[model samples]
Target: MGLEVERVNEIAARVAASSGLEVVEVDMRGSGNKRMLRIFIDKPGGVTHEDCANVSRELGTILDVEDVIPGGSYVLEVSSPGLDRKLSRPADFQRFVGSRVKLTTRNPVNGNRYFEGRLESFQDGRLTLELGAPKKKVKAGDSAPQKVEMDLSNVEKANLVPEI
Candidate 1:
């Protein structure tokens, strides 16, 4: 993370924590006059519009006063992670154990880089996935394994598979 992003993240975490929220992710995109700062936040039951507005109000002020964002003009958007929230951090994987997830690996695992399955467990910087049945029909003798394990380093991207 860049120094500015780290500083913004620190400020965001502080502001979010004050309102009983967790800062899921802090992203700074674009550049120059079109810079955009997006902060994703969450709580047990999910976040509300008021929660987002309040955090935006406070965090934006702090960022401006602290001059954490460098450029004076930038769009600050605060919102919940939503149902299909990202699973980037180890804590995210640990917290969502038993939930379905779709992930792409940095390299192929079992000749496949993509997987969607139940997160059975996360331990020792690795995760065990209980692979779900394939969407396509299986041949007489060709079938995927019931379980697979991979290190967290291999995961390039991952998101919850919303059951609903």
Candidate 2:
């Protein structure tokens, strides 16, 4: 099953690249005939409805030809990752430095699993975040905002917190 998902990711990446886009994520869910394959794509300026339509058509045909999933009908959907896009890769974090983000770690750090802060930097596979709200109150003139440093490997999920 994992291999099938990897194959789908590879196929989606290759197809998206040919179409001048990058595959942000490929998700395969459900089982049997109910399975659905969702592919998220993006580029410098962002993707259009046409981009989604083209990728969907091309990837669907390729998957069908490759016989990747065997005897099952799966719904194929391709689209832009959107404003609150997920940060799945280390480079994603690096690209969005200074943006607000909300992330969850696989294991609790400082007895907490969730964090929302401004991304400060990403270097050597580590991320530094300027925590937006301090866990404890400090006098106005006492201290600067707190910071948290975490390794990429510890991240279970992360998304850009769109600042409106």
Tell how far residue 108 is off in model 2, in angstroms. Answer: 3.6
Model 1 lDDT tens row, 1-164: 39888888888999999999999998888988889899999988899999999999999889888788775599999999988999999999999999999999999887788889999999989999999986455669988878989999999999999997
C-alpha TM-scores of all predictions: 0.92, 0.88
Residue 123 of model 1 has an lDDT of: 94
Candidate 1 clashes between residue pairs 3 or more apart in a chain or in different chains: none
Best by TM-score: 1
Q: TM-score of predicted model 2?
A: 0.88
In terms of lDDT, the poorest run of 10 residues in model 2 is 136-145
> Deviation in angstroms for 32 in model 2?
1.5
**lDDT of model number 1:** 0.91
Per-residue error for 29 in candidate 2, Å, reads 0.6
